[model samples]
Target: MSQSTLVSTRIDKWLWAARFFKTRSLATNAVELGRVLQNEQRVKPAHAVKVGDILEIHHADQVWQVEALRILEVRGSASIAQTMYAETADSITKRQQRAEYRRLHTEPAAQLQQRPTKRQRRQLDNIAID
Candidate 1:
């Protein structure tokens, strides 16, 4: 194959094609913001990536560790996207653990019914000072 048909592609584009980001701009922003790390180091959006390179991506409340397996220029179906990378076992375990923890603990904000009255607020402040 000619060099033009090679599998090498930009990291950001691959991220979008792999369904990690909804849009190219979002993928680009993630890289610029340092949420996407290649080989344990931050990389630019245009950084070239090849199969077998490890990518650490921080998305939402979890981090994903995936090994790139293919490079394409266009986004495809979710199943096809999944084939682009293989997630690490450690990442899978940590994600499941975090999900369980979140399920058990829930969000603290969810426990609040309404705004505290002034008297209750004052009581809270007083307790903090002790």
Candidate 2:
């Protein structure tokens, strides 16, 4: 069969080809959970995707807007994956901003351990009760 004549590929395969998810199953699950959006609309795992489609993928605390550049029937290597989809610059900036904010606002577990003991807790409770 010619390379271009491959039958319709699944959305999960497309997501994997586009490097949206590390595994095909992960992509499928994301689609199933409504975290995968096509043209700003949620799509199903079986959705047929082609080139030039914009996908908004919600991953962790950030959202990714990936523009499809090529279609692949099979999942390619990490190097080839880079050629399939292009991530919008805004998504990268947003993710970086979120990372920076989290780093700045989150307190370390070690510092959180400095909280009061039973005596302090009792004193505070008494104050609240009074």
Clashing residue pair totals per candidate (backbone < 3 A): 0, 0
What is the alpha-carbon lDDT of model 1 when measured against the actual structure?
0.91
lDDT for every model?
0.91, 0.81
TM-score for candidate 2, residues paired by index: 0.73
How far off is residue 45 in model 1, in Å?
Answer: 0.4
Local accuracy of candidate 2 as per-residue lDDT tens digits, 1-130: 7546654467788888767678889999999999988888887899887778888888777788888777786777888878878889988898899899988898544354678789977876898899
RMSD vs true structure, all candidates: 3.6, 4.8
Residue pairs clashing in model 1 are none
- Determine which window of 10 residues in candidate 1 has minimal summed lDDT: 1-10
In TM-score terms, candidate 1 sits at: 0.82
Error of 2 at 105 (Å): 1.9
The digit string of per-residue lDDT tens for model 1 on 13-113 reads: 99999999999999999999999999999999999989899999998898899999888878889999998899999999999999999999996457668
TM-scores of the models, in the order given: 0.82, 0.73
